[model samples]
Target: MALTPDEIDGLRELILAVYGPVTEELLRDLCRCITAAGQISSGDEYKLLLAKSLAGADDVIADTLRRQTDLTDDAVEQLMRWAAEKTAPLEENESLRNIAEAYVKVTRKEVANVLGQLAAADVDGRVYPIKDVYRRTMDYVFREVSSGTKTPEEAVRRATLRLWQRGIRTVDRSDGRTFSVEFMAQRAIMAKMGEMTTAINEKHHDDGGCDGWEISAHSASAPDHEPYQGRQYSDKEYKRLNSRLQRRIGTLSCKHIAWPIKLGVDSPQWTNEQLAEMARENAKGVTYEGRHYTQYEATQQQKALENSIRQCKDRIAAAQEEGKLGSGELRSSRILLRQLNAEYKRFSAAAGLRTAPERLRAAGLGRALRPDGTLEMPRPAGTLTGSGGKLDVEEARKSYSAYLDTLTDAPEKNMVWLRYFTEKNPTEYMEDGTLDAPFAYDPVEDRILYNPRHPQFSTTDFEMANTHELAHRTDVLNAQGYKNKAFVDAISDASKAVLDNAEGFQRVAQAVRSDLMKDILSALSSGRLDTGFGHKAEYWAKNSEAVPLEIFAELFTMETRNDSDLFFVKKLFPGLWKEYQKLF
Candidate 1:
């Protein structure tokens, strides 16, 4: 709940009254003490001396508190709480000070009004009636003059003359109001307290991952003041605002405070069954690439796919404009677009959307009849390529043959077609193409893809990448006894022993045993690990489930780089490494 603007105005009015007298006394004490000291040259020196002076004003303090300003003790406490909540989010001392500075600036106008009243009282026998308003103080001043019981013109004239004497023309630039430092100090404290309260409330809700807040209006607040009072916004239709800009129970300055409401506590509307139903409807659990997504996660994944599809479309449009539509660039982009649209369709269907969940109309879907009744394949949109236009197939095949010659225990060269990607259509190429990994193996399809645009694609050591990808194929393809269930079971049994004996592998193995394996494998498969050799080594070694496939690839590359690495490779997988080396 937030304080309504009217309530805030009333509180400010009351606080101004209370603050004015105390402020005047404090200023008086500061001046007297500064004069006594006689040599305050610096700001720090002045503040130090001012602090000593304020400590001596016991009688003034008692008198200031004794004066009735219409604010109850409860109201004062509420203001303190408000101040705390506002400052609660600030963690650093410097950040808290910055917030305090902002509050001090806003409240300075009110401080100026109070100072004007005090100044007038000093000069004239009577004081000018004032409120802590920043703009149009004269309106309030004139209103006071007309409403007061006695000598309206006399009071106005005396106050006006006094103001003139001090050269205080406008409330904004009140050079005569010399007590700004003290005023700012008081406001800084109040602002920090309020900010702390905000931080506390936010931390609670955030930590719990709870939905919405329980808004309550002030007790004395009128019926028409805040209709939103006692309402909740936990539903999907209600979009939540950022915490600071979030609507409170009442308008600004209203003394309404909102508290975090745990789900199923005060919210009878949010039953466990309803939450489960929402999860089923919106976030229908999605499993992709061996990883499962919750309702929220599924929606987020769909958004990602949509974004990729859009970006791919933009790239396709740019390629057409550049007259590259006839090149492999267009075909590669179309291929990627096709893959993305397929995945997006699958996701949407799982989430229960109405659009047909089918493959995009592309080259593979049979031709539709022309208006003249001629049999024609419906060519891809915006394509200038002829029906038989081909990529540089011969060059890619040669590269694949050369790459295979370097592999020792690599699968048969012809087993997988090395489809050289001519255009790096960011969306499609490899499984984790964004990482720029040179090669990717699709085990289900038994195809090894070579990314021609990879940074290491043209390098002499490119065969190492081929070895890495080939490791995946070797495990899955029916080379000797490789593709059988028994082979996978044997690898699993062997991996258990290696994991038990390996240093730093047990903790990762333990993590893999828990529900964390999916997340770890996803990270590894996507190449999301931090860059650099050491980080890659640490990542691959730790992901125990992925280690079986990854270890061979990593060791193969390492052995190709230096023969010394073979000692460790043989030690790790004596039987497999020996067998794999025979293919070289």
Candidate 2:
């Protein structure tokens, strides 16, 4: 088959237009999946990239083959009708019919083979290596396709030709199984004609021989065979012609064509400059959503959103792992994450992208903080909260589960179970004169021991009991002794450093350094530091034995209640307050 330069050029144009956008969209989806999985290395990333490309190729080829069959069927039917309309009817109609039928079957098999190869690669997580020249050809093909100017037929032809060229190029260097482009084109022409011949012969079996039918061979590439040019044969004779002269016509680099009869063809033949101009026309950017984006620019935007969401999820995981969920910084981080999630949702919706369901994890745990900037319970549905006369074990369990969601630690998750206990005497205060605290956390057992007595429940309050004990447990299970004497000593050292450098405090606070020190010391010793009278000496040891844990528990409780206790604590231990925030 001798295809004019114009037809080849038109075929290239059609293939680019059809395959461009489809391939681009596929690549974007694949990139997002890989980024979300946190696979960034070159080899691993490229493996997925290749898998997606193969899948894209399967789609491109499948669509192309379907379209090619439609066009071939139409072209052959038109040619057959034109031949039958002639004053002197021609033969070879059977050959044309058989070729069209065979072409469809052969191309369908080829498409299926490509799809099967891609499926195997996907299952094995393997990537085929692309040669540099083939990669460049595909890149150019994508650009032209994205330009959106070529017809579907041209796009399909160009895609098929490029891939065909790659195979032929490699086979020549390896085993020489396929000789040249002309040989390949000629073989395709023969296959189509052969199928058409078979179909026509089956239909005209009652007719003896091909009386009015004629098959002719034409080729500009084989001018030396002028004797064979315009050679006509009957339908039955055409079937034998292949065997008679198969060696010369079906060999390496042979460019030949067999037309059923008279042929009148007119197609645009582009000049070198005109072809260059056509390529320029196909290089223009596509417009979407009021903005123009090159294929590369659109790909970059897709990658940025995918990577940003992945990073946000990673941070949340890290904070949970470190058990710093209660800190002010982590509270702020959660707020930032909420904002990122909203952004992700909007971006994906706008781009018509689908995000993973895992992105919705911890949706209810938004930025909920107490007034003093401590993180609060997420309070997801089904968590128990209010008070009643008798203890409802199930409700208590649900409420405790909700509270536990706010904390982070092994003990907080596992051993810190809740149970009710009662004292022999129902007194408002312990014998030690400390107020009878309703709930006490047992360090040894890692449990919250609750006073179930009616008098204690009424006086102690539900939220207070829940928040205070959880805070105590957070200190024991997660924060450990980070809030203890060592922490206080760091405060003392920082205080000494600041006070000794009086100019520093003067600059930051605009206060007299001596007066500030005097105020802090006075407040620390005023017995007000021992605020919130509590039951059992175990909860708050006297004097210096009062672990920083008690002070933190009290402050956290006060913060949750929105009381002024946080301010008092800050004033009494200004140095500790400054250092405490950093420690947690």
Candidate 3:
């Protein structure tokens, strides 16, 4: 089994607990030393005072190293139990249990030895002995205070920030590489789990005399491994393939697993076309703040943001503990934390990714505070309001929120208000009766007017209408209104693609089909062409210029809901689908 977010968080917390507190205390002591050494005339005099202040610092460092080793051993024990539970049935066998235990024992020692090193570097690329890092930090603090460049409190806060940002680095001098203690621990744990699982699976395959295996499939798989997933391969063929791949299956950080299968009995789990579509969807990732990010890239961004938030919280706590609650550092850090939290929500909503609360937590940190001293919490992405209607207002809001959750690229928060009306119409009908449509987008007022009393107000119908109207609002905000040249060109290309595959279009479910010809004919005969049609294109020929806008909205709804019409669009109108994806 893969490591869950909770499990990862727990491991990180344990690793940080081992070193984080020790580093914090060290900084605190150094700050105290700097504060006590007031107005030293020369560097030598300041060094003497600092050395006296941190008299037993060496002993403290030694004690911390010992504690870290002990904690690492304990963490490894927990990790082993987790791994054993994941490979359950196999653990019942004594031989396998013994094998796993022996491997864990050896890995545990290596992890402990590596973590015992206290070599770390600061933000300015200054490397220092873990024991001597505090001295250098205090020296910098003293210089700033004595030179009148910063107050004693400000210098202390800066030192705290630097320590939290870098954490305690475990350096590998051989390759000149450094890793935070938490990162190193995570890597060791994942590697151990992967190796154990692979060993157990191989033993099973051997005992069963299996000649073939199937690899598991997951979203956002690495491109090199995408083709091999959800497919059955003979043992020999798989071996040959694995040898040539850059990242082989069952490797560290590779989530794929090879399960034993009978050569002629088991079939592939997914069809080639489905796999191809999955790849296409992964490639066409969501857009946030004008930057495109694949699913994997988005998750990575979330991790970075989560780390920064934790650092901010830590800085605030350290400042408060030092009785510098009103310090500029504390105030700025609080403001930045709030901004990070809000940005996290907006980015997650836009990318259609769920936020992991566990990842945002840090030990000994309370809720962030606002300028008024009240606790601050993140707000929802948008709001829904209903007026003058028998509509289940709460239900409507819930339904709208649910649709937003399903969107890969959601509209900007509060970009358009949602107003529902059940007993009355908000806008007069157009000459061709398009304005009286069930859902209408009012660009001037920046709201979507929904008439739930319309005949097509079933659950599914409501969802479709919601999506269709939201698409129009999104288009207007993003594409400079629906009649822009770029949108019109895209619609023209998609229309051509649809025209080329008229037979396929006819096969689409009637409810989902956009019958442009019927609308064009009605507009020609109705004599309503003189007066321009409103928001929607009920009569295409009447407002020929709006054909692209109407088609774009319909296609957007289909794509968002994954309606069957979209399958036909992708199959028969590849050009159209490709163009449609770019508009978002």
Candidate 4:
């Protein structure tokens, strides 16, 4: 495991006290990796070559140092010996330390000379492709930081700061004490670092299937602190913030150069054909009457269009207020607004963001009432959170009733009754949600749910069950929307690939359920342990399980801390529990 900053600092001090002085090379390697992703180039390359030779290579580190560069075999051998002698056993003998430091002093001078020569060659040579290859290699290097620490989340953020040479994303900007120096170095490297963008956007180099780059670090972290290795190459809409470093306009946005650079194209004047070709290449293949619009160009046009829409709205509002516009102009203005929103929606998928339709729907500022006494989208009690509505039972029951009424118009509109119950202790509730029964949906009964016992009747339990039931309804509708079992099978392979998708949901299903369960538990027992699991069972009915309501009650009875609560539910509810247990 990687040591914490405090732990590492302590180790460093102790090593210095015992050994007199420590090897600067190991510390330097760590600092170099943290300086800029580019700084770690040689070390990373060395590690890769070492890995390739893992099966058998006589002194792989030495071999790598010798073959990958012009360094003599003897010099490489000497450095390797010094590194090995100094890297570990810090709590052991001290006499060898003097010899190792002597070797390091010599190696440093040689290293400085070699790096100087490489820098000179880069300044005067064709290093574009070579730099691109190096950046891609660094991308892989950062992707593996997960292997170094249990807190992969922290590791990812740390690596991002170092990789970009920008501020560490972990400390929330202002919360740094010991980490501030590292964060500053990280931020400095990322600021205006254009070469890295050129490397990632190399996808747009030939085929132009790019819009533009937007860079954000990703996290590959498991809850128990394991490495989360997955996708590394970012999607297209990500912006390259250091655009000044990468000075080309997008394909569509290149309508007229906002600013032009003659750095790459050689001649001061650009041909019409050349400009058009460049723009098309950047347009990334979305043809407009067979002429492709470059991604850079499209972004510029989209921004201009939005500005035009905003102007139209201002003009119309002013005209109406001043009594200069007729009813016709007002109606036309509304239509224009709709069209602008639609355009945003169209580009949203490519932009990798929520479509316009989603934004409008979520605002919930508009509504329609059903004949059945339910509001279609009642102003949701200010976005559902872990803790639910007004804690008064009467008001909560009313809110729950309103929520049920709203769902009544939900297409299946068939009366969907789901109840949930969970254990009084939330940790236990959480443990069960994650482990024991991670929601097994039985589509046959049209019931979806989760229930943990509640010690007392409270808003938290009610909120938990309500969210779970609603989610189950969504799951059912989604399954029904599938074209055929075979198509769903294919989608499952691509999405919820691991589960083989017992039903038509992706990896997101388990996640959604978990959050919903948390909300349910959060809504109950604000500052105390609940008594039992009746409400949890009711929630299981609609959110976690597809089993009959009774079987769920039986399952809760079979596996829970409050067995007496099951008896209480059975005594009160009766027949349904016995019938449900038979399904097994």
Q: Can you give the TM-score per candidate against the true fold?
A: 0.22, 0.25, 0.54, 0.21
Tens digits of per-residue lDDT, candidate 3, 454-482, equal 44332224544555665666667564435
- Over 4 Å off in model 3, which ranges? 1-45, 52-55, 65-68, 147-161, 244-246, 317-326, 357-584
Give lDDT per model, in order.
0.40, 0.38, 0.56, 0.30
Candidate 2 residue lDDT tens string, 495-529: 46555655544343333122222223322333222
Query: Candidate 3 local accuracy as lDDT?
Result: 0.56
Each model's number of backbone clashes? 31, 22, 0, 70
- Number of the top-ranking candidate, with TM-score as the measure: 3
What range of 10 consecutive residues in model 1 has the weakest lDDT sum? 357-366
lDDT of 1 by residue, 1-584 (tens): 33333434333333433443243333333223322332333456545654554455444444443441222233344455445344354343454445444544444434344333432222342323222111122232333444563243333333333322222111223443333222332343334334444445555667668776765532223323334444565633123432334433322334455656665666543344544454344344556678877544554577578556544543443233223222344457667877887788777777543221111112111122121111222211112112332213433333334333222222333223222221221112233345444467666666665544456444423333454465455545423333334433545554555545454433433333211222222233333332223224445456444544554444444443333335533564465565554433
Arrange candidates, best TM-score first.
3, 2, 1, 4
Please tell me which model should have the higher TM-score, number 1 or number 3: 3
- The better candidate by TM-score, 2 or 4, is 2
Off by over 4 Å in 4: 1-280, 283-292, 302-341, 347-584
Q: Model 2 off-target regions past 4 Å? A: 1-337, 340-390, 403-435, 454-456, 459-464, 482-484, 490-526, 529-543, 555-574, 581-584
- How high a TM-score does candidate 4 get? 0.21
Clashing pairs in 3: none
